[model samples]
Target: MSIRIPPASWAFRGFVLCFVFLSSFPGTILTQEVTLDSIRIFTTHDWFSIKPTVYFQCKGENKTVFPDVKNTNVSYSFKGEESWQPLTKLEGTKCKRCGIYEQDPLTHDTFDEWELCPSDFTAEGTYTHGREKEFNATFLCHGCSQVGPGSNKESGTEKEEERRGMRPAIVVLIVVLVLGVAAAGLVVGYKYWRKKKRQQEQARFLKLFEDGDEMEDELELQNTL
Candidate 1:
């Protein structure tokens, strides 16, 4: 008994796997009543995400609280920065202090910038690009939508801030991309070259076989003479 795969079927199998890998990545959870924040305010390291989540519940007088999605003016500042820079001035939605999606075009990762979360308890986590290290993050909320807790709206004199240094996040991303492209190029190039070499070798062998038969015939004729 022999096990064999047809050429077309093998190619089809490889295509399916590549599609799945590129479509979605691990550690990414999409769920209801959950907000994932990936903040990129820190220029020190290129690709870092400050992920935090808040869950809310009804309180006081046993009243059921409806989601009063309010203006979450997201601002970013680094440690020891003079003032925070306003990234998104204001935003409204059917969410109370929910972590929303914000993207950075330079490094191409969702930035965590949304502010003020409502919850019975808050949770936050931090990890480097590609699971290098795990660390806990601390975040405080301001100007929360007070359906049952406090404050409805407020504003203050904003400060100015500047980003600094090569984000560790950016460096890691560039390195990974370069390695991936190099690997794919090598694999594809090798397959193409091997196929051409096999064809050329077969042609050379055929020509030598024909020459050998002709030489045998000439030697027989000379002997007969």
Candidate 2:
């Protein structure tokens, strides 16, 4: 004899089956969100200017793989700015590999070499001379889909320190220049004083010689008489 199942029991079973199927393939059932793991801002002190290099660390869902960074776009804005400005992708090698290879004793083959990966995206640009010192900046990747958590706040502090560092050097240069001018003036004044004293001595000696010559001429005339 076959047993009949209740309508409610059949519906519950069907719901359970659907739940199990979705749990087994969570990636398909759940939406994947792209996020930024971290961000770094590198400030380089160029002659009379500061260059800002922004690096972005993008991470996809565990089962999802990220595509080439060139396919994505990025932009940034200062703390008080109303709009976002595009960031130009920097060009060059962004990663490096350094490891030693060892031969397997039994297989007589080398092991897989390990490598170090860099940030997924990088952009280079210049900040206004004092703008970096004034406020923090934020970066967005993939057209504002991924954002950095105000990671560039340190940029302002670094810029202030850089400017502070220059102060001592400028002060030193000014001091040296003042000392040099004072030394030159002293040397010139000494030379002028010596020349004037020498001229006075020469004039006195000439006057004395003239007086003795006149006396000798007068004595000669007396002897002749």
Candidate 3:
């Protein structure tokens, strides 16, 4: 007689094995928390001298206000240990259009706006952005690399910077190439002009010798006469 195993038991074992396999890679399955590491406001959008009520927000997500960062040109840092420390959670490889804004009575004045991505962070899990006369900020998100669109996906700011950096080099290279071509043309022209001049000089010298020979022949004929 052969003992048979129940289908329910097999199903339970399979479920447990799947759960264990998934648990091995928690970074891929769970949303990673993005926390504000530091921030510095260069200018305030508020008209009056009163401190601006600054906050961070992404599209479709509620604002994460910074109660302490009320002054301009002051840098504030965080330990990501507060109750509201993790400002938001990044799902999968998706990037969020986020910005820092000043709360106002009439309108919410924006400090700076940018695309935030997990790929923006460094090996230390930190990302920094500085908008001229607007704001400078640093963000932290541990295990961001594991949940990002891959190592190849760069932040918009970094890509823009790379493009900007390449422009000057490209312009310089083009200028150098143009100058090189112009120099080569000048050299060829000078060589051709020199060769023509040398040929003209040789022809002039030969003509002088020929004229002398003719004069000598005329003198000889007269002497013969």
Candidate 4:
């Protein structure tokens, strides 16, 4: 039979369990100092290009201006502009808070590696800082221009039209390899001058058949006397 809970309700239940365990730890709840809560502009177009991108959102911490309250913070115009362009703090942009290591099952050693450390902010391009927001600034669209082929003057005019389309296929493959080595040296100099004129016409027909068999052996030895 016990029922007594009251010392201002046990100090309001121990300040609501230490504000819900320090608001579930993440920089231990100190949010309520930054403002600029909305400003998105992300247009993109082609066919007379235009590509604007300016996102800046914030609400209670991630501050970059507007602390004592009195603001203009970041501005923009162009949709029938009336003058308000004032967003220029993008210098080396920054925002990195990553560190959560844990490996030590019996000295596999690697604990916290750098415990509870998160602070390195400088999002430049019209200053930005914390609060899961991106696209800081990138406006340069005046009658837009940036046609494709990764412009460098369209990649040097597509490498001078691929070297003027490979100089007429390298001058038609060096004029068909110099007319195929001048038609294989005129068919090997006309088959070596027709095999040296058929070996000088078979040595002049065997010297006219050995001068007609030496005049028939001197008329059969003068008819055997």
Candidate 5:
């Protein structure tokens, strides 16, 4: 048996995104968003491949991975969906190990270690601006959180992003349109049904009136005879 963090509610990972006006490149910093689309529970032969993916950030039109993602900035769900427990946060820990991202002062390319830790990752012990590293190999998301469509969250600026809380604008518009069309169809059907019902009632009242007149004539003739 293995000790693991049980499934957590849907989580929306976010962070600040600021660009230095790199002459030609432009970008906005409105809290980077990340969703745990899906997490498969299985075993792999490697160690880091089996470790948890702590933080998934968007940097300069790119999605990067940080395995040293301390337990802090991460939240967990012990019960069903929507419940969360935050992991322990780490301020500055040694990030010179495997999968730690850093920038080479000479090449400026993100690599792990010298022999083990590549040169691409931002060294935890080094790098003042915090270099974001991308782990190329895929790994198992231990204590993985399920992702929701996330269109119902209410949050303020700098507020944490909720899973499935705020949906993409285009997606939200499409959903609203579909629901509107369905509602209109129901209303039209109801109106037509009401009209048909009124016609049926009129026909029934006429039939009853005609039968009553025939009965009255028979009674009058019997009395005269």
Candidate 6:
């Protein structure tokens, strides 16, 4: 027996399947913004400058200047109220090439360069980078605190939960398909039984009519005798 499904219902089923498949995987990787909490300059890269302009930059991005951090051995702290509040955006624990530089008339001088990773930060949402005779600075990203090596367990748990959540949907889909097939089979079987019963009744009726005709012919022959 063949079951015919409507076109609109097929489209709806396709949409639901796609939604479930897409939802099973992780979502888009969003970048977290990092801000400068505090910074101290151990030494100045530019000489003959009473007050030098210092800034930090990630690769392929614009620089975030520290207005107060100009003199060496001076600790500059920020309340995260700077015009350029967030220094950079980091995706998960991935690292980016970033450095502190001193602005110059001709060329910018680099104080320190390193690969900055979100995993390097501590649970308190603080990360410090330092170079001898160059500079030392602390950065903050509250989002980073929830990431790192320790977050592996949490991530794994989340993934497991997602998998578990999908189980019931799949089971329901299977059960529905099975029940549809069973119902279709039952309808076809019922139709076939009804047709067979009607054919048997018609055959019995024709047999009874033929017997009556033979009996009538025999009685007429007796009468003629």
RMSD of each: 19.2, 35.9, 25.5, 35.3, 20.2, 12.7
The weakest ten consecutive residues by lDDT in model 1 span: 155-164
User: What is candidate 6's lDDT per residue for 24-134, written digit by digit as tens?
Assistant: 443324467889988888876555665678999998899888887867788888887789889988876456778999886655688888877777788888999888878
Q: Give candidate 3 regions above 4 Å deviation.
A: 6-28, 147-225
Error of 3 at 112 (Å): 1.8
TM-score of each: 0.31, 0.32, 0.58, 0.25, 0.27, 0.55
Candidate lDDT (C-alpha), each: 0.34, 0.36, 0.76, 0.34, 0.32, 0.76
- For model 2, how does the per-residue alpha-carbon lDDT over 164-214 read when each residue is reduced to its tens digit? 765675576567556755665666678689989999999999999999999
TM-score for candidate 3, residues paired by index:
0.58
How many residue pairs of model 5 clash at the backbone? 28
Determine which window of 10 residues in candidate 5 has minimal summed lDDT.
9-18
User: Model 5: runs farther than 4 Å from truth?
Assistant: 1-167
Question: What's the true lDDT of residue 39 in model 6?
Answer: 89
Best by TM-score: 3
| Steric clash pairs (candidate 4) | 89-126, 90-124, 90-125, 90-126, 93-124, 94-122, 94-123
User: What is the Cα-based lDDT of residue 96 in candidate 5?
Assistant: 18
How would you encode candidate 1's per-residue C-alpha lDDT over 102-146 as one tens digit per residue? 223344332232333232222332112211122112333222222
Write the residue-wise lDDT of candidate 4 on 1-225 in tens digits.
Answer: 956333355445545755675464432354212113233322212223322222222222231321222112343323323222221121111112212111222222111111111122222212232222221222322211211112222233554575576567557656755675566566667767888888888877887788778878888879986
Tell me how far the alpha carbon of residue 157 in candidate 4 is from the true structure, in angstroms, after superposition.
2.2
Q: What's the lDDT for residue 202 in model 5?
A: 94
